[model samples]
Target: MALRLDRRRLVMGGGLGLAALALPGGAALAKTLLSASGFTHGVASGEPGPDSLLLWSRYVPAGEADETRLDAEIALDPDFRQVAARGVVRTGAYRDWTVKITLDGLEPGQTYWYRFIGPDGSRSQTGRARTLPVGRAERFRIGLFSCSNLPMGWFNAYAHAAARDDVDLWLHVGDYVYEYGIGSYAADDRIAERVVLPAHDHEMVALADYRLRFACYRADPDLQALHAAAPMVCVWDDHESTNDSWEGGAQNHQPATEGDWSTRRAAAVQAYLEWMPISEEPWKSYPIGDLATLYRTESRLIGRTRQADIGAAYREGTEAALTAFRDGVWQDASATMLGSTQEAWLARELRANARTTAWQVVGMGTIMGRTVMPGDALDLLRPDLSEGAVRSFANAARAGRIGLPMWMDRWDGYPAARSRFLKAAQAADADLVMLSGDSHNAWAFSLSEDGRPAGVEFAGQAVTSNGMEKQLGVAPSVAARSFVAANPEMAWAQPSGRGYMMIDITPERVGGEWIFMETVKARTSAVAGAHRMTVEKGRRRFTA
Candidate 1:
């Protein structure tokens, strides 16, 4: 049997939708002539807009010091026969030995290929790319994932997506890379606390350290394959900077041990932009015909206030945590998660999309809208929730009934911000759909305003990192069903599974499918469960 992609979408290479031809060598194949340190790292493209996309690659030159520009060529065909655009881009240490070139003047909804040539005649890999479709396009697809912790498991989810050639774009909603230096989150003797390439065993605090970490992650074959095949629109959640990060501080960040927050914060953002196949721009949007607008918003390290810690709720024991949460702090509008700036941006976009588009699609971190806990929707592992003594840390994630971490940590925590954004969607006369990560579980919910359903949310599961499964590993299936039975608003959720999500947006209705990994403990990427979730237009509700 042949190795297959999780989605079975991977097609063997060679000029997809275009003519196949051999690429011209600008010089001696430095891959042959420039030697080992050539473009060892490979190439990736991201942030596909209406007519352009950002192309990125890294090369370790052969010499000590010479400013050189790579003669880069991009075309609609693999053979470079139909060159859409060509240019010279400079790559150097200033940007951490990387090349960032924004290609322009191309037709919308087209597939393209790009390659880089160094001074010594070396070539980076032939990277694949595509543009968003033009006006009133009926349907488009997004491969969504989040919360990938390298030390925790293999990046099989990315690998699974890569083997399939179907998705037009990939949206990695945070935890693209973890900040924990190993052993911190995973309790293990063999996986010792990561001896970070940056001296410190705790958290990353410097540029070089941050760079090294990203480099190591980008080095993953699975992550590389996914980027190689699809254009990615990525957004950061807390883990990218620190655990449970807010405007002022973080759950894992310590000013004492890590020095100043701003410096560390900048270093994280800088490294992220430099290494990942994403732009340095904080937020952006991709216009998808007149059907909908994909609005990418910054949910962490920007305007998000300190996450609702609700220390009163979680003082150690799950029962105490439950008791405390029921007594107080589930809804505190005065305590803001998204500050004024981002809040305003989201509102305005919703209003604009509502006027003309069929749907307002908000791509972001953290679950949006409200989720009631202790209800069946939060079917965390009550039966054997303490399996391996792993408390329901991530169960509360998709819905969080145990730690109750200020449901505001998710959309539940920020009732006011959720209201403000949803109201904008309602006023825009637009059907709304929110794509979220950060919670690390699959969820489908209906968003309501003033007792009227306004939007629907489809939250993706983790790429690899452990989630509700950690707390309720004993009988995940039963727990999931129990949750659905309990939560009326929440149509469904998989508290203890890992996988990616796919969304198909059209004029009539918005549909979602959660593809659960067959098993994380195995190296092979396989789908455990493939579920269909649909939200009818104007109804603002999810159904099986």
Candidate 2:
């Protein structure tokens, strides 16, 4: 193993060796203190459709094994005076103390207020969410978000979107909650090592730890506000569980130490489903009045195989085991990103949407493109920076690789699946607009099929979590120039900033704006700059 035992254990959130029988920190104490106030973890709604929407909340009780179900009300007024729909959803540890229910029979494009009430009449905060309209929609606003590492900074982007009066939906590209140990993802200086509240200091495995972690992040007002503001559509990237996660395991997960991958993944997924207001499905599509069909895809966890290490594979020498591994593995058409079932389902969704919709929208985890790092850009940045994690990043300016960064574990890795999807898009003749996040930077590209324009993609930057600039300390201008110069398909990119992307659609074009924050150190940072661009209809190219 390139990484030693201690490294593995450390990566897995301390060690099973040190895990005595009971979980660290008193769970009883946490349960006694947890309550529902001001929405407590705040209120959220998601999975908007022409007919229904899903809303979520969490209420920890005063005793062990004591479940709490709140009377959730969806209303036309924020004051709850005019109720449109109401139901009861009970919270349980099986899903980590989170409660979510979908309210159907809602009018399209209409706003609704929702709150959860406990048995004692203690109520959660009232929040608003919207449903997609049917036929001929002129415009819709989405709160674009990615990478919300609590310690990096505040989720001001989420908060910012919520406070605004315009947003109709919130789109989280991925990294909703990082799965790293308290200090592994963020340095102590930025947010102290022991800062993780409810004390999930080690790797989280139990339901309680995951619940506590979500509580810690949701406690942020900005995140709460955003959840309060609009309906959300979410997908997972690697960090939501671990860096470079596959269906079987993760780069950061140590089975011997952190325990089983399935156990950890379930905990993460359960925690996420509980905390966020998204629906039960891993992925789904929403129809916007025949104008666009938004497809929220599931990339992480479900069915991703481990990535091939080409460099190492090439070094396996002449043995048959190595030869078999090296020869057919790279072109293993069997290996996949989305499992066969999902791929088929997606094709059906895309084809079906294309028949009636003007735009087929996809919200995914990674950038969908083939971008080989420019050796020239590498030469410039490597010499200027000291040898550290910054240099480590520069090393990705690889001499020659099979594809892109796999785009920070992107579509490029799953070549066969990508080919199938592109073919599906072409067959459908759909005006495909893909929204992606994961690189922690903004990107707009024209997807091509064998060099012909096939679709368009706009990847949003991070909300508050660090990007290449934060990790590498590369000057904004240098990083921007390096990437733009190297990547011709990249219409516009900001390698140094943290922000969200706005997609405003009409019949003729899809206009995208990168709403960057001045700072994320506080809950209410103002906009420093707004980069506006658009993907014109028929052309399928990003024209800034």
Candidate 3:
């Protein structure tokens, strides 16, 4: 049976009683009890295909601890008067009361409203989902987002995007939910209003911890609204598990204190799958009709090796040591960003997509373009910066003096892997468009391999994390100009901003507009500013 009221009206009318849980402060207590019963964390949809998509929701009976069943339905309208599909799904504590149902046999290029119904007739907030077009897609816009640390501030970027009707899908490259505890990585001034749940005030390391963290993030109204607005394609970066995570361990994880790395990694992955509206596949591709082929690649846990220690090289205080590290460790041909198997699959996919599509877009976790900090840029560092941040900059500056890129965690550190990927694109003669997030700053890079233009990259800024402006003493404009001047491949840079990227794909070109929020410190979606850049088809670079 359909709920008589509209979904938006239901939420605005406080039918679900989540307004207090969505706010800050005392809401933390409500969040903690949310999982005990009822439909918690609004509905979401993802893993969209031409004829199918995955629906997700979390529900628990008030007095039941065992598995419970819920009825799922889809319709052409919010009122469900035109009911199109229906199914039943089971959820229990084993899966954290989260339910995911993959509904197939649906029409292509259509929008559907979906909701879950409890046994007692309670309904989940309606969620909107879309299926990929089968052919001749004139245009598709993806709202690109990442690095959303809740305690940092309001999710203004998400709120802004949720208010838009143009975005066809949401692509969160990584760091959807940070693993940090309260105050560990949040803005000091915003802690009172953006507090992490006290029960989860330590870095997440266990299954329960990760589940609680996801619950906390999902309780936010802005995030839930975004999920409800459209289907999302998401992947996890390091922070979803821990900071700077790789195949074996993470920079922030201490085996001595955090238990086994594999155990923690397993818990993180399990919680992610249960909470997110994604498939079990580590990587996958989406075909947007004949206009574009979007490949979501995995770059973390599956096959990434440990990041090279650039700081250690710099600490050696000798050009010889730095050169040795750069030549031997940093450029190790066998070290991979994406494991060998995924690399081969990506290459094959790129070639196949190029044969039929106008664009081959790769969405990954980190920036792919080379970003060597100019030695002179160090002069802009803020004196009040933490010692660790200063040291990191110093090392990067030292490497820059020798023409080495900083941030070994990025593609720059795995030079051979990057070269191989670029060569694959060049060999396929593909019109490549790379989308990335991880760095808190906005960037546009003209990618090249051996002086031959290979692709163009539009890396989005963080939704709320502090960017270079927080660490640098100079103004944002000066820092951006300095960065652009320092890196040849860099076409543009926004050193300071809290925003998301809007990527518009057409047969002729792909355009990206970075939309910055006026303030994350406040709960507002007023636009601060925006910058647009585009690459023409077959250009292999951003248009000048």
Candidate 4:
């Protein structure tokens, strides 16, 4: 009998379906009896190309000791009546029981349903995937997301986007999973029903810990639905490994206790690559027909220099100290975000894509626009803040008064590098649209280089992590207005929200609509509000 499953049914049914087989005594025996030996997590697809796509699924066998062989099938129809491509792949404990296979020889711009079949007739949940277009294309929509801290709330943003048919792709810039352990970073604030996995109750340090963390995140029904709905292009931010990670070390990673940074970083990367539906390459580009070239770059682990310590500057407690820190440390001409090799590759790709496509979209972690905290906004800080927190905010505001941006972990910290990137875009005469995350708030920026308009950036709000409203005493509206007034490049700001962005790309324009959720505390996808901003074809700036 053929098992036909729809999206809703697959979503409601948490696990994969296993067909019943007749026993020797003529009784029907279901494979579900072996609860530990089936598709553990749902299926996912990513790394889409004109004729290829990468498919992923995790399968646990009853034996658990040996490798498990599985069959992968892709079809234009959900029922698999018209099978397009089929393959066999193996997964074992080595890769955390996760299997990823790249299926080629498919038509471009075609939607296909895929699933994995086990030896015992168990079938994974059906997932839909689409290939990138080859020639001229009219429009493309991407659901942008980041910073999904599970303990904070539900993934209503993912659910909202997954339920919609408009989004063709999912672009998660970074922080897909937070690395914090139980009782730290919003633990007390966690939703009542959401509990941390027993094995992942501590900060992730080893490969096994990272693997369990990903499994916990992937187990979310909403996240699985999002993955099943469309292919995702994802990258890891600092949280995937540790907070504020750079090339050599991280702000949160203490080598003395955490062992070698390199060892820990390797484990994190290995687990991420094995668990996520992405290719082995850390940075790559996806060409969306002749419409746009979506470039995903690595900004955190590869070439990023250590972030400047504004806390140290604040401790000095002097304008001269802040100025010295800004000029000497923050503005280091040689500091880089994407590093030298990736930067050069991106510059070359930007120029090349500009010649071929109408729009050049760069997807990377962290906000690229300049955001300086308004001095008056500091007074709006919540009265509950500790003395040290208050002092830090005060120092940040003072530094902002001296023309320094608030976040040293973002593009603002690497001014010279940002200038170089903008200059590259300017030289190519490209219609650039930069999509970013990691700030946890929404922002629109009109980028410029040497007083010339370079491009526009749409920084998406976090999926669930709290924003400025949680810390500021003032309302979100007041904070947003103050931020816009303080930063000239910032054309718009949403100081508080938990949601994602729907970015539409067309030949004439590219627009991003920030869709805010009603409440992440509940398991609902109700819409609270939305804000839209668009940049015309050649203007390289947001419209009035």
Q: What's the CA error at residue 97 for candidate 1, in Å?
A: 0.7
Q: List the residue pairs that clash in candidate 4.
A: none
Model 2 residue runs over 4 Å out of place are 1-39, 61-65, 185-189, 192-194, 198-201, 311-330, 382-395, 400-408, 471-475
Per-residue lDDT tens digits for candidate 3, residues 1-544, read 1111122432312243323333454344434455456787888999999988899998878774588899999888889999888999988889989999998888889999999999889999999988998888999999999999877878989889998988789999999988887646534634444555433346898998888778768877788889999999997899999999999999999999889999999999999999999999999999989999998888999999998887777778888888888778887898899999999999999999999988999999999999998777668888788888887887788778777897888998899999999999999999999999999889999999999999999999999887778787888888888788889899999988899999999998999999999989877889989999999998988985
Residue-level lDDT tens digits of model 4 in 430-506: 99999999999999999988998999999999999888787888888888888888898999998887999999999
> What is candidate 3's local distance difference test score?
0.85
Off by over 4 Å in 1: 1-36, 185-202, 313-334, 375-408
Say which prediction, candidate 2 or candidate 4, comes out ahead on TM-score: 4
Error of 4 at 193 (Å): 1.9
Candidate 3 ranges with C-alpha deviation above 4 Å: 1-35, 186-189, 198-201, 386-388
Tens-digit lDDT track of model 2 for 1-544: 0100121231111222112212454354344224432234667888888778888877655456557667888888888788888888887656656788888888888888888887677787778888899877888877678887766665657656766887778788898877655535534324431134344456556666777666656655567667778888888788767788889998788788788889888878877777777767877888899788888888778977787665453344334533454356555777777888888999999888888988999998888865656554444453456566444444445422323342336776666677788888888888989888888878777788766777888888988677666444457767667666776566666776787878888888888889888886654568888888888777788776
Clashes of 2: 5
Error of 4 at 34 (Å): 14
| Model 2, residue pairs in steric clash | 39-42, 134-289, 135-289, 159-222, 406-410
C-alpha lDDT score of every prediction, in listed order: 0.70, 0.71, 0.85, 0.85
